[model samples]
Target: MLNRLFLPSIFALLIYGFWVSAEFKVIAAGVAVFLMGMVYLEKGFKLYTGGLLENILKKTTSTLFKSVSFGLATTSLLQSSSLVSVIVISFLSAGLIGLETAVGIIFGANLGSTAGAWLLAVFGLKIDLSSYAMPMLVFGLLLNTRAAKPLKGMGYILIGVAFLFLGIHYMKEGFDKFQSSIDLSAFHIDGIYGILVYTFLGAAATVIMQSTNALMVLVFSALAVGQLDYVNSLAIVIGSNIGTTVTTVIGAIGANAQGKRLAAAHLLFNVVTAIVGVVALNPLMVTVDEIATLFGIHPHDYTLKLAIFHSLFNIIGIALFIPFIKLLVKWLKSLFNDSYSKEPLNLAKIDESSMERAIYLNPAVLSYPDAAMRALTKESGRLYRNTLELICYGIYFSGEQLRNTDNLSELAENWEKEEQPWSIKGLYIRHIKGIYADIIHFAGALEGNLPRQQAQELFALKVACRNFVQAIKHVKHIYKNMGKYIESENDEIRHQYNQLRLCLASVLKLVDILGVRRNYNHIQEHAAQLKLELHEQDQQTYSTLNKLIRSEQVDSYMASSLLNDSAHVHDACTNLIDGAVIMITRDREEYREYDLAGFTPAAQKTSS
Candidate 1:
């Protein structure tokens, strides 16, 4: 409802301002062009995100100080704290960094953003940058026409910088011209009430612009032209700092609970900083004056003074929060628990309609490659677990029975006495199909910004999910005759069906063990053993079937069913083992090293 009215109202205001004064029109145009530059700048930086940024974050965010330094460096380089915030949120959602580390990064980003104010105050206001804008735009346009993505990204950045300079020029000239017609200084108020009012106005401007850096540029330009008072500018700076968290809050809307907690931390940091700045305004201003004098800045240079205050207040906020990082993390965790922490695998209360929703895929993580890949891999694991459960139920066994590490033959024999039956088709639709579809859809939707190796990992996980579902489908084919044969009057056929049950159950148990194993060498050795055992079981079943048929222990009807079911069992076992290998093996290179070790004839014969 607000959006419907707000947009038209802004348009109407723009139309009226343009009709009222040419200077007002120029200022508005300057603001628009500046905003466009900000958009392009963010776009250019985003092109470099997936791998390089992810690696930097992983290497640098190990300690709180390092996280803060990384955040400061990144925000200073990008000139977009909002982008940094979104990246941090994505990292937290992806489990790339802890909440405490994320909070530290947010703290550092606030201090880093003050550099924008310093740059604008010291250089932007003093130089005639518009003189260089035309050449930059020309070069940027030529570079944009190139086919390479990095070159195109560089072009956008150049164009963005040019537009920003041009906008600053226009805004400065427009404000200077407008000053002759009306005195903005006459409207300026003094004291605490004035600070409160101007701070609120500053926050409103930032919320409307959605970029505090842009707001700072505008404020500096206006201050240079003697249109804004230093005291009110400082108040607006405080408000803008608090308002900057809106971007993170918006980004966190689709994020997991951890992302939301990081957003909350961002808001808390900014709000606390604003409150501190407001409460200690007098003492801070005095210190800023002293610092300005010590640094050889003129008292009349309000733009530089504002920059000093911006940095000083943000540094104070960081200092205040650094000691309480653990407490803040504890509070955030207490406020927001993991969304998927509930009973994810409760079979008794399965909601058929809820299968379409993703269990691990969060759109917020897509901005960071590491986070996005982790989400895909985790969701694939969930799908694999669900497939295992469905396969167990299809074979007239409970998931519990499949997971049990007790004597497999005794468990299978005991489960055979139970008459429980389930619909494989129904379970597939309710449990497997929807999750499989979601996993494929989610994996396909990943941004093309991932590193080649990570992209391959994502593809491998998708293939693993496909193999898991296919294995379950194979079990469904055998399920039709499984219960019938296991209870048949012929002891030979019944025993063979029981053997098939035990063989598949053993494969399931081995896969579960593989899931928990951490050592790369142990995983490889165990996975090879599992492959050899399955192959041996397949050969033993085939030999037993052939012997029973030759001895006339099994008639043609029984032989045909057993033969077809034996093939289905082999396919199911092979698919399950392949999928489990992909899921458990973290390093493809290690798996490659050990893959051929298990296929040797000597090892195979010894296992058999």
Candidate 2:
């Protein structure tokens, strides 16, 4: 059993068992089971946060209203607002939108999400589209086998559209039959508790369905068929808001601090809004009723009014909270803060929470690397400052902080055990891997829409950063393993470390060129000169390895490992600068520079 197949089989079997136990009809049970499966699938799809945002932007580029329609339609087609919200959240986290701008988009997303509801309300109640679903699915299956790109895309669209209508049809039929036989006519309950129960139901449904759109459609169909009322529907809507957070929460679980933050923000927004909604239920519901009546609509007209209310609540919430975003953010920080954590967090990860936090940080940094670098420098400084504070606590206030001499002894033992040279070596290995990956990504991005000169400059900076990662790691390694390693015998390690520092210095000089705007010629000249210097340094580092090893003062493994690490660092730096050169020299018809001698043939390939 393949890993993916095993879970779906188990889920199907479990759902079959549940449907039989729940006394649900076969069709209703099938729909319920499929929805359960959909939730898991949508959650998996949400991992590509960046690509999702790009698609959202692509769909929304024409006009704001059209964009909203496109968003709604696309989400309806996809059957996942959590997916759409995820894209929106990523854009927000990436600083693609300001707080005020994001407020509207978030509102738009809420509106767009209602498309599925409208579809279900109209089609589920008035028409039977389930008959076409099988044909559409079959057609899609055929199209998927075609070699053409357009055919494949159409195939996907057909399949998605078919599944969506099929799901709606199944849900409607289930509820209609369930309603006719089982009397769920009315239950007199307290307003707040009723709202809470309905909201919880909505949340649970959305979570199980893995889609707010699905729940919205269910609510719409249920109301259209008169199985549920406005108050109950409204409560479910609020619950759907809470349940939607589950996708992002799951997305951020193993992700970095930034991812966690975005997920947290999403959870916070839904939970807070739901709570406030519960508190304001009576007045808000009345207001909705009054507004609907004023528009010459019946109080019982659930579809139009439901959509209106969903839009209204989110819009009002966004408006009311926009000005107090900073305060809300501060509150979130206080709420989430833990005194024991050592790692710093990226607030952008709380992307789904609000635009204020998500839409202003990452894009700013990625768009303007200089600004990002400055910000990173400041952050690095802060990290070091915190480290210094900890060091002070260990030094001056050691006795007081430790509480007892035995405790101090325990702390020392723990430090010796936990912070060993092996751990430092592991960090070094991880950093080296990251440097290579970053360089490759930088090269690929340079080959795209960026101007030749700009590409080169970026390439130079990437090279410098790679060198910096190596040099910093070497410093950590030396500081940790200094007592054990023989400096006289380990001259190879010392010389390699020195060469690494020199490479860093060259990178710093090249980075200076990248700090401000410059034309292609200037960027090219700087990159070429820097590459030459780096090549020379690489040669020097490699040349000294034999001399240092012949002395036999240190073990061969350590000496050879140090040399190999140096070579890796050298390659990373050289590749970065070379990538810049390719970007800069690419546009020229007959360029004079081709410094391919330093690179291995495998590494010489560039996009341009």
Candidate 3:
């Protein structure tokens, strides 16, 4: 509703302004071009999103100071606090960085925005950026036609820069022309109400324009042309600072609870900063003038003074809040609990039509490769858990038995005297197929955009999904026999079947250990060791089968059934081990090709 009401109202105002004064067209054109440039700029940056920026954000956000520096630097380069804020929101949603880190970045971005003010005031207002803009636009559009992604991204960035230049030029020219027709100084008011009114106007304009950098350009250009009072423009700056959070707030709407918490923190920081700037308005202005004088800025050059004031305001805000970040984070966590988390669904209870879907795979996280990659891995882990559950229930091994260190031999035994075993095939279609398809579809959509490292990571996830399904298929193939013979009247077959169950339970136990532990070397160690154990188990099972057949303790038919079922058991073990390793391990190394663990299951023939 705000979008609907706001856009039409803005258009109406622009149209009326154009009718009243032709200069309004040039100003409006500048804002439009500037906004378009910002869009291109953000897109250009995002094109490189898969690994480069994401890895940096993850590593650098370890401390409050580092997070703030990253925010400030990126916002300075990007030239739009709004874009920076939104990107931070996406990062937060992906679970890459914490709320404290995110808030630090946002606070720093406010300071970074002042860099744009300094550039515009000192250079943008005085120089003919239009000349530079023309060449950039030409070069950018030409490169944009290239097929390579790097070239395309550079082109978009150039075009964005060009548009920003042209925009500033047009706005300056418009205001210059407007000074002759009407003195905007006449519209300027004084006192507390005036300060409040102008501040609100600045914030409202920023929210509507969706770029505080653009709003700053407008304010600076208008002030340069005597169309705005220096004090009034400063008030607008305060408002613009508050309004910058709008972009983050909007971005967070579709994100997870973590994203919303970060957005709230951004809003809180800016609002508090605005309040400080307002209450200390006179003193800050005095300080700005003093700083301006110290730096040899002419007394009449309010634009430069405004830049100093902008930087000072944010600096003061950061200084005031940096110490309390931990406390703030604790409060935020209390305020925004993880109520978004869903209750774990029982695989046995799910309807085939309404099988589980991806939890972490949301459209909001897809904007950044790092976020999307993390989310994919997380969702795959969830699927792995569900598959484990289905495998346990299908084979008549109690799920609860796998939780602790009860003897594997004891846990492996089928405790149920009489119970309905879930159909493994039914569980696959009902629980695995839909979620697997969703993961596949999501991964497919992200194929080309990722860097080699990120792409490979994404591929690892797909392979894990396939292997998981393959594991299920192997279980499904042997499900009926395992259920029938676990309590068979024949002692030899029952003991052998229990041994097969123990083999599976052992592998499941390692997988459970991998899931809980975060030590990578230990995971690799355990995964390699499990493969060895499965290989040993395969040899032992073969020997036992031969012994049973030769002694005639089991019939030829039972021997043949055991032979076929053993192969299925071996394949299933291989699948679970390999798949679990891939799902958990970040560095795949050459371990994925360990022995015969990468065996292609019979499910490979199906049109998955």
Best by TM-score: 1
lDDT at 482, model 3:
90
Give RMSD (Å) of candidate 1 vs. truth: 5.0
Tally clashing residue pairs in candidate 2: 14
Q: Write the per-residue lDDT of candidate 1 for residues 230-327, one digit (tens) a residue.
A: 89989999999888999999999988788899999999999999999999999999999999999999999898899999999999999999998998
TM-score of each: 0.85, 0.59, 0.83
TM-score, candidate 1, is 0.85
Candidate 3, 406-493: lDDT as tens digits: 6887655537644554567666776778779879988988767676666766777788888888888888888888988887899999
**Which regions of candidate 2 are displaced past 4 Å?**
1-23, 26-52, 55-79, 88-108, 131-135, 186-190, 294-299, 333-507, 515-525, 530-576, 579-608
Report the lDDT of model 2 for residue 442: 35
Model 1 ranges with Cα > 4 A deviation: 342-353, 364-371, 392-431, 447-458, 479-494, 509-536, 546-561, 581-608
- Comparison by lDDT, 1 against 2, better one: 1
Stretch of 10 with least lDDT, candidate 3: 599-608
TM-score order, best first, reads 1, 3, 2
Q: All models: lDDT?
A: 0.80, 0.52, 0.82
Q: lDDT score of model 2?
A: 0.52
